[model samples]
Target: MSGVKMNNVIKQYGEIQVIHGIDLQIKDGEFCVFVGPSGCGKSTLLRMVAGLEETTSGQMTIGTRDVTTMDPSERGVAMVFQTYALYPHMTVKENMGFGLKMNGHPKSAIEAKVAEASGILKLDEYLDRKPAALSGGQRQRVSIGRAIVRGPEVFLFDEPLSNLDAELRVEMRVEIARLHKEIGATMIYVTHDQVEAMTLADKIVVLRLGRIEQVGSPLDLYRDPDNKFVAGFIGSPAMNFLDATSGEDGVTIQALKMTAPNPIGKTSKAVTAGLRPEHLEIDPAGDALRVDLVETLGGVSFAYLVSDTGEKIVIEERGDEPVSEGQRVGLKFDAKRLYLFDAETEQRLRA
Candidate 1:
């Protein structure tokens, strides 16, 4: 295992710069994931680390080696791409051991390495099968096994499970987490899927439009988001945003009244209020809303509603009685659960 360091990394294409200055330190054996929307320069940064793309200006070091200008093969890294790039005609074992053979390892050493990787991946039963005959999940494992045989210092995965079905994706996600634990290798993954980043990462690096937003553990980011974007992007069903304004001694939502923690200053203006769906309760003593749709998912129910001011919100309610559409209901948000942010900067306000 090895640590990765990026010092003032920057990337550009001609005169148009895509990635701004970025500095990060990924510890040895840590599973770090970069997550963001499309065109956020996440993949571009990952490529720079893997030596697949050159850094326009910065220093990249792996372990104790300065590999900023090293070739991809000499960077001591292996990358597993979104598309399972397997040879159509090669058997699983052949594909896994191909890198060793090309590097002039003896036949016995190559065979031993392939056997070991196949065992770890549980591909022993399907080693004779070609890519066409294997399932999508199996093919992805073969891709990972190929990277493992090289014994790279770092492992890079770029949306490795996006092509799988929902259930298969979940299964493969668990498999990847287990593999990381078993191998104890430094791995960096990039994905747009928040679920993948939340479940598989020890630390998540949130990026937006060529610059990093924040870096922290999944739960830390969830419990205390630095801004509205991080809060909305990290959670499922997304956090609800409501326009709020501060009065002489309190804060008020559209048509729904709320109290502030303290007196609001003119400069400490409130613009947006955020709350997660799970924090809302259908209490009789709360603000009233009209239900638009209720989606029952067996274990829990999601109530989609519209406030009197026309703002949409979702509340999680696990109950026996089903809520129907167009039904008027009251909602109580846990006061301690609310988040306030600046409307212009989208930055979170201190509680």
Candidate 2:
């Protein structure tokens, strides 16, 4: 396995800079995922690591070798693109062995490598099938199998499952995770999907506006986000943000108020109170809200309501007790799960 390093990397087109100076270290055999919205520079960063795009400045290394200027094929890295990229006339075996053949590897060596990768990916049954005859998941596996045959030190996946159906995507996700465990190759994946990043990564790299926002384990970022953006971006259904003003013991959120143990310092006069939907509970005898909508999802249900001050709040509830629209109800935010951030800077203010 090999690790990857990017030091003070920059990317620019003409005079406009897309990627600011960024530094990252992906450990050997670690499943590192780069996640962010479009125009966030995640793909550009990955392309730089693969040598598909030249870095405007700075150094990049794979393992102990400086590969900033090395050709993609010479860097000992393999990339699986989103589009499958398989030849229409080629069989699965041909597609998987094409790279090795081009590199002058002997026919016997190429055959052995292709057979091994096919077995690992369970593509042995489909080796004779063309791309047109395979399912989306099978096609994606072929794409990955092509990479596997290269015996690369590192694997780069560029949203390989984006085109699959929801169920197939979930299945492929598990397959990829298992492949990582079995091969133990260092992997870097890029995706805009939060759930994908949260589930697949040993470490998640969150980027925003051409710069990295934060990097940490999934739960670390979830449990303790450094800023409002990280807090809101990492969770499903997202954490709700309510405008608030800090007072003696706690902050006031319009008519609905909650108290914290310690007050935010004078440096932060105003704060935004954030509550995950799952952290907000419907309390029959608590703060009143007019239910606007309720969405049931088997084990959990989300109730959307308008607070007494007309601000929107989303609450998670359990059981079969149904909530109706336009019904006035009470809700409470779990104090322990609350997040407070500076209103101006959007940085986390208190624990």
Candidate 3:
């Protein structure tokens, strides 16, 4: 296994520079995930690491070897793309062992490696089946198995779960996590799905507009984001932003008619208060909020409300009786759980 490192890396397509200078590190055997919205350059950065895209400037290294200019085969990395890229005429065994065969490995050695990968991915039952006969999940597993047979030092996944169905995506996430745990290889996965990043990543690298917003453990990013963008992008239903202004004693939220203590020192600048959906509670005597809609997902519910100031907020509901649509209700904000950001800069105001 080998760690990957980039020092002020930049990528450009003639005059259009899609990737700005980026510096990052992935520890050996770490399951690192790159997550961001579409056109955020996460895939471009991943492709750069895989040697599929060239680095316009700066340095990149795999382990102790500089691979910025090296060929894809020399980078010691195996990539599993979004597509399965399986051959319809080839059986699972053949597909898995094809790479090794092309690389001129002995037939017996190829068989041994294929057997090992198949065992790891539970593809032994489907080895004799062709790609047309396998399910989407199984075909994806075959694709992953093909990468495993190469025994590369680093594994790169570019939205490998994007093609799978919801259920299959969940299953594949578990399987990939298990595979990482069992093999202990350095792996970098790229996906726009925050859930996947939160579930599978040992370290999550949140990117925005070709620049890294923040890099930390999943919970660290979720609970302690550096800015509004990071905070909003890291969580489901996202963190709610409320218009507020700094006051002498505390920050006053006009929308909720609440004042949360300013943990940071007093500031004259306008502020935006962030509250996660789970942190807000329904209170009969609190600020009145009109429910626009309610989404009940079994154990938990989400109440979409329009505050008095016309700001939209989502509150997670856990009670047996959920707040209904078009209902007027009061909301209580947990001052301790509140997040404060500078309205102009959108940067967190830390205590």
Against the true structure, whose TM-score is highest?
Answer: 3
Tens digits of per-residue lDDT for model 3 on 1-351?
899999999999999999999999999999999999999999999999999999999999999999999999999999999999998999999999998999999999999999999999999999999999999999999999999999999999999999899999999999999999999999999999999999999999999999999999999999999999999999998999999888668888888877777767676668998999999898766546888999999999999999877899999999789987877888776578989898989999887
Highest-lDDT candidate: 3
lDDT of each residue in 155-273, candidate 2, tens digit only: 99998889999999999999999999999999999999999999999999999988999999999999989999999999898888888877665666764555553344443367888
Query: 1-351, model 1: which lDDT tens digit per residue?
Result: 799999999999999999999999999999999999999999999999999999899899999999999999999999999999999989999999999999999999988988988888899999999999999999999999999999999999999999999999999999999999999999999999999999999999999999999999999999999999999999988899989875556556764555554333435366788889999887554556788899999989998989888889988888788677877777676667878788889998774
- Clash number for each model: 0, 0, 0
Model 2 ranges with Cα > 4 A deviation:
255-268
TM-score of each: 0.96, 0.96, 0.98
Please report, in order, the local distance difference test score of every candidate based on alpha carbons. Answer: 0.89, 0.88, 0.93
Worst 10 residues of 1 by lDDT: 259-268
Cα deviation in Å at residue 271, candidate 2? 0.6
Candidate 3 residue runs with Cα over 4 Å from true position: none
lDDT of 3: 0.93
